[model samples]
Target: MFDGFTPEHLALLRGAGVPAAWPRGGVLMRQGEPADRAVLIETGVVKIVSESANGYVSLLALRGVHDLIGEFGCLDDTVRSASVVAMRPVHGFVIAAPRFCALMEENGPLALAILRSVINRLRHADDQRAALGSSTAVVRVAQVLLELSERHGTPAPRWAPKARHLKLTQQELASAAGTSRESVVRTLRELHQRELVETARGAIVVLDPEGLEWWEPEGD
Candidate 1:
């Protein structure tokens, strides 16, 4: 979201925030916690998850470098709506709520950029909700795979130049697709048989992303 910011603007933000590092699986922000600060991700990926009283958890979004987390709670002065967990080793800066508000007020361009980012997030949420309501489990899983590849997958440097790998567990994929782990496993098996994706212990490599995109669910 800070992609539009100038070097001076980024420097100003970094100066006003405290640098922090998180190992994979660390919880950056917890649901229901007070919104004390917002994190600006400098590197790595994080997953936003929402948990219910019944102990069910859902993956709401995957955020990567240059994204800002916890801004919604800070902007509204409410408790965090979802939990943010590090999907990989993460490096970022934490800006206190008051300082963040002050910085936005002092910088019109920064405020505008943040507003646009928030709008985009809302639209994405709407799209996800619609897909969850209407799409089949196979379609949902495929959609999540495509989204993850586009958002967080790392590109191959030399070998298999056009392929990308997603560092996600089957459980995480199930959560993101809003389906049972068995269902995701079944869908993945079908994809695997087609030579579209290869799944290992805790990761999936997209060998034929275009094939995944063109795949049709049963009865579709």
Candidate 2:
């Protein structure tokens, strides 16, 4: 969303909110909470999740720098449908609902940019659901890793200068993959055996992106 913003629009948005920060594991937004404010992330990552009545939490998506979260509930005048939690220490701005709406009403371009962003988000969600329904556990896990690598990965000098490190926990990876942590562990082990990746406590290093991208079960 911020990527599409014009300089004037970005300035307007940044000016509307109060700067804030959240520690790792902080709850930025709670599911079912009353609509109040939206956050514009400037640094770090957050996980969006929806919980079932029986306490089953489904990981919805990950948002990072320049993403706006909690806007949907504020836009539609509804309670929050999901929770946003910080995956790392986060710094951003908190814009109250009324102010946020005012900004949207007064700025046509900003509103249009936000609308396009929402549409893109929905499309991505649809594609992810379709992939989950059709893909094997290993494939799903691999896809999640690839996405994390593409989005948040940085060079891991501790592993190899060229290796890409994905900074996330195994359970987070499983949640994103729509599978069990055990399954993710097994999948990572296999990837390690194939020399495609290396895992530590809370990170994974992509040793071979090309191999991982084209990899499939031997018999498949």
lDDT tens digits, residues 40-156, model 2? Answer: 888998989899999888877888888888989888899999999998899998999999999999988899998888888888889888987899998999988987787777777
Clashes of 1: 0
Q: Output the worst ten-in-a-row residue range by lDDT, candidate 1.
A: 1-10
Steric clash pairs (candidate 1): none
Model 1, runs deviating above 4 Å: 1-9, 156-159
Candidate lDDT (C-alpha), each: 0.86, 0.86
Cα error, residue 9 of model 1, in Å, equals: 4.4
How badly does each model clash, as a count of residue pairs? 0, 0
TM-score of 1: 0.91
